[model samples]
Target chain A: MMRRREARLGWLFISPAFFHLVVFALFPMGYALYLSFFKWHLIKDVRQYVGSSNYAFCLTDETFLHSLWNSAKYSLLSVPFGMALGLAVAILVNQKLRGISIFRTIYYIPAISSGVAIAMLWIYVYLPETGLLNSMALGLLGEHGRLTPMVASMLGKPDWHLASIDFLNSTQWAMIALAFMSGWGGLGPKMVLFLAGLLGIPQSLYEAAELDGAGRWRSFVSVTLPMLAPTTFFVLVTSTIGALQVFTPVYMMTKGGPDESTNVVGYQIYQEAWVTFHTGLAAAESFVLLALIAVVSLAQFRMMKSTLVGYATT
Target chain B: MRRKTWDKVRGALWATGLYALLIALAAFLLAPFVWMVLISVHPWNTPIPAISDLIPRGPDGQVHLDWSNYGLVLFDPNLPVARFLFNSAFVTLTVVVGQTLVSSLAAYGFAKLHFRGRELVFALFLGSMMFAGPVTQIPVYLLLRSLGWLDSYWALVVPGLSSAFSVFLLRQFFMQIPAELDEAARIDGAGDFRIYARVVMPLSKAALATAAAFTFFGVWTDFFNPLIYTNSVEMRTLEVGLSIYKNSYGGSNWPAQMTAAVIVMLPLLVVFLFVQRYFVKGIMLGSIK
Candidate 1:
């Protein structure tokens, strides 16, 4: 009798969350899958049954392909750099010293700020004239800098001649600039995760390594690196997924500008659905992105599993 | 004695290098916000100041501060800054409270209740985390359109009431609470709801605060949903409002735009400053496990 009541209460407790999941999450996914097969436009109220044509169109679409490639390139550039900088900062701040929390707080501020705000700030930072980046680069390169003239001469075109290159307008540098901004903004949260992982590492492990005459670098490589495998894995997977879905910066800063060089798959979906009102094509593209993420995540899990097992035996 | 001296020299060198690196990283993280503040107070109708001239001079060669930018942005006819702020606050508060209550209840059930298919239900909730936002963006918009909820607060608040990530985080924390407390409460004839409300909730304050902070931060800073759902200036949140301002008057009034940006960003920064420990603890709890 009590068991029955307990189960009843359990069902009651979960009903609210379950309702939201069905309405907001699961149902939308199901509806998206269903809608992908039809040609639908919300504004025009046009719905026609077109079986797999949307998917076929996406497959052959050059814009879609380029956006996918852009997303992949973005993920490649940001994830590793973000992780490395995060880990470096984490190690630096992990030291037992005075006023370390101040440094941690400074690093974490960008992570908590609005994405649009960061994007806006970076827009100013990347402006060609009087922007922070160009000013700093000019200062670093000195008067008539070697690399500036070299880059200008390499292009060898009269139009390409410039004292300082425009970071956002130039196709060659836009994606890289965006990636650096993302990596910098993302460093805080990633560092916090690494710091947490670092704190969890037992001090005795380092002591034992010291007793064995191991240097600091050796202990870090063997002890700290292996123990942090799980944190590293988690950060890698989450950050890669985040990089793949990046939209706000692209929208706010570049609008995928300077010849569509910065157009990412996520922004492409937005434009298709909202701007062009091609809901069916947008849905198909979303599914394509879903499939790509699943494959990459599963591959990462499999690769990490073998390495984790290797560490366990050793 | 010689060996000790060599070790001391190396240690001092390492400390200096570490401090140098830390300062450099801090500057990289903070320079933009510093510049934003400087530019916001900079006198209008001047060229964008150099890094050296952060505090620009007026035509009179006196250091004239431009406090008018804040007034201009706040009182702008097109922007509706106060209304947007109120909208953002309302939406953020509702989502945070609703998500906390719903996720906590579900977490309690998952942590303590022995119902059939419990593991399966939890697994399903976890699986939903991998569903990217784009996958659901259009369908949810369509669903809202059918329900006649577009350009309304219901569109923002209702769909965001439950989060799988919050549920997972709370469930982990709930599981760590001793079952003996629940049993003791039961012995006193307190039912499951009573124990959940009185016993479990009180003991899980740290986790609850962390979850609330995370939800607050996420909702307050979210731009994508607000942009899509709201059509008019009256309904826009602070993020979308600020972006609209940037799009419209960005070139002519750079200081006003920076002022608006700073205003939008200030609240979360203040909240973060006060309860920073909880924020870090919350992040650690969510990620490390």
Candidate 2:
């Protein structure tokens, strides 16, 4: 009787969350999958049974394919750079210095601010000529600054000009600019995660390395990197997933413009569903995105396992 | 004595270098915000000021800041900035409170109550976290539309009422509270509901605050959901409203745009300043688990 009462109470208490799961999560998953098999017009309320055609079209769609590629490019640009910068700041701020929390709080400002606001602000930051970045560069590095010539030579384009480089308006630099902005805005959370990982590292390991005459650099290379493997893996997977779904920045700043160079998968999906009213096609695209995330995450897990083994062997 | 003096000099130099790097990085991170605040105060209907001219000045070379842009953005006749702010604040608060309550109750059941398939149910919740916004957005929108919840508060509040992450975080915290406390309450003629309310809820304030802080920020800054769910200007939240404002009225009016952005950003910054401890603690807890 007591067991029966407890079980009943348990079900009662969990009922709300269960309701959410059934209505929002489970139902949506099955419905989206079902919707993927139909060519449904959201506005016209028209439906046709089109088995696997939506998926086939998505796979062959040039713009959709390009959007996926753009997501991969963004992940490539942002994730590693963001992680490195985050890890560096995390190490710097992990000290027990005076007023350290102040720095931590300031750094974290970008992470909490509204994405649209940040994107709007960055629009000015990347504006040509009178904008913050260009103006600052011009002020510090004169009109005929060697930066233009230097970058031109490095890229093997003698006429390539860094001056008046309208970052968001230029096809070549738009995605890169977005990547840098995301890196800046996302640095705080990654730093906090890495700091937590750093705090978890046992001090005795460092001491042991030091006792064996390992210098600061050596100890960092051996003890610190090895110990931070799990955290690094976690940050990597999460950051990659986040980079793939990046929409607000593209929507606010670029709208997948400057020759559709910045058309990320998220924006593509949005355009398909809402803008073009291709609801079924959008559902299929989202499933493809889900598949991409699963494959990427699984690949990361395998790569991390191999790296751990390599570290152990070394 | 000379060796000791040299070591002291080196240590002083190291400390100075560390501080200099930290200060420089902080300045870089904060530069955009500083610029936004400065530009928001520039006079209305003026050309986009140079970085140096952002701070207003008179003919006499005295500092004279103009807050007219802020007033214009806030009290514009055509724009419903006030309405958007109300929608954002109300929706965010409702979601925070509702999410916390439902998640905590479920967390209590998962943590303390004995039942068959408890672990299975909790595992399902954990697994569901992986299939967030992108996958479910279309179907959920269809569901909300069918319910005639479009352009309504029901659309915003209901979808955000329960989150898997909140449930997970609260469960982790609730499990740490002593079961002996519950047993003691039970022996004293209190039931599970009373024990949960009187015992677990008070003990879990910090955890609850952390979850609420996350919810508040997420709901407040959310752009996509409000954009799709609400089509009319009257129902639009601050994020979507601000974006429309920028595109519609912000052609060359940089100051007005900046002012609007600042208005949207200010409340979150102020709240963050006070409850930042919970933010840091919550993040650490999330990662540690």
Candidate 3:
């Protein structure tokens, strides 16, 4: 009787969250999948079923292709660089140094700074004149600043014949910027994870390596790298997802702009849904993105031999 | 003995190298905030020097340091950033409370209780977190629109509450709680909710704190949803409020916007440091840690 009462109470306790998920999350997802099979604008809508046509359009659309490529670019830049930077920092802070936690804390701050603010700050830093980058160029280069010519381009004068590297002007650099920023912002979580992995590494492996005449780099390779595979694998998968889903900064900062140069699939879906009012196309795009993420993650799992958490035998 | 000496030297070198690497990382991480503060304190939207150095040089000829911008953000009633703060705090606090209670209860059910289809339900919950947040915007908004909740707190607070990730984290931590506690609580004739409220909750405070802090920070710092959903100037959150400064001052209008950014970040900074002690308990939902 007591067990029965507890079970009843448990369901009662859990019902609110279940209700929320079912109402807001599960229902919307089902609706979205249903909506993807047809067309409906959320604003003033009629529903029309088009079967596989939405998927077909997404598959063939050059714009979709561009968005996917941009997303891939961002992910590529973010993952390897982000992981490398994270590993380097974690290795640094893992040592027995006083006040190192301050560095750890400071480095971790960016992870909380969010996308819009970081992009805003970067915009200031990259400002062509009187901004950090140009100002430095002016000071260092003296009178004939290398970036002075590009100033003309902004003025629409002589096309600022030189020193023109518009980071957001083209698709490639836009992706690079997104990737780099994502990496920069994401460095914190990965570093912390790597730090934990570093701590988990048994001291015996280090001692064995030291006795075998291995130096710092050699130990890092032979012991640290091998042991850290799990952490690296985890970081890579998450970062890959994060990079692929890049939206906030691109929307806030660039709006996929200077000519849709930086539009990643995530941003494209947002635009298609919200801006263009093409819910069906957006839903189809979302499914495609989900499929891509799933495939990539599964492939990674297969490739990396990542360990399951509680599985002692793995 | 000679090898020991070499090891000592190696250790010192490694220490030096570590410090060097850390210094560079610190500079990169701290540079933006430092620059933001500098720009905030100054008056001109002019160029800061090219070096990533934190010092503000008053754009060649200007001499007087302009702190008027900072004051304007605080005192200007027209800007109404203070109202934005109140709105943000209210919504954030509500969501934190609601999410904590709901997610923790759900977590308790999934973690401690024996329920049918628990594993399947748990999987569904986890999968929702991966469902692109933006994907549901239209459909969800349409529901809110029908309910006429576009500008209301429910749209902000309800949709923002109790995510799969939070549930997963709390459940993971709760499962790790010794089963003896629950069994003992049951033996003492405590009801499930009573056991949860008394024993489970107090024990799970670390996990609760982690979830609370993350949720608070997320709601407080979130820009997109608020920007899109809330139309009224009065309904705006701090993140959206700051964007007003962005539009007015123009992105190029430095010093002023950075001041606004600083103001936006100040509360978060304080709350972050205060809550940070509880925040670091996150070991990820998986046990790879």
Deviation from native of the Cα of residue B192 in model 1, angstroms: 1.3
Fraction of the native A-B contacts that model 3 recovers: 0.44
Pairs with steric clashes in candidate 3: A130-B47, A130-B48, A131-B47, A132-B50, A135-B50, A136-B50, B39-B255
Identify the candidate with maximal lDDT: 2
Q: Model 3: what TM-score?
A: 0.89
lDDT of 2 by residue, B1-289 (tens): 9999999999888888888989999999999999988888877766678867878787798998888888888788887989999999999999999999999999999999999999899888976786555789989999999999999999989999999989998988898898899989999999989988999999999999999999999999999999999998899999998898679875588888888889889999999997888877788777654
The estimated TM-scores of all candidates read: 0.95, 0.96, 0.89
Best of the candidates, TM-score = 2
lDDT of each: 0.88, 0.90, 0.78
State which candidate has the highest DockQ.
2
Model 2, C-alpha of A32: deviation from truth (Å): 0.6
Grade the docking of candidate 3: medium
Model 1 clash pairs?
A: none
- What is the Cα-based lDDT of residue A79 in candidate 1? 95
**What tens digits encode model 1's per-residue C-alpha lDDT throughout B1-289?**
9999999999899888888988998989999998888889986545678777778678898887788888888888877899988999999999999999999999999999988878888887887887646699998998998999999999989988999989989988999889998999999999889999999999999899888888989999998998898898899999998998778875566677678779888998998887677767877877855
Instruction: Judging by TM-score, tell me the better candidate of 1 and 2.
Output: 2
Give one digit per residue, the lDDT tens place, for model 2 in A85-106.
Answer: 9999999999777889999999
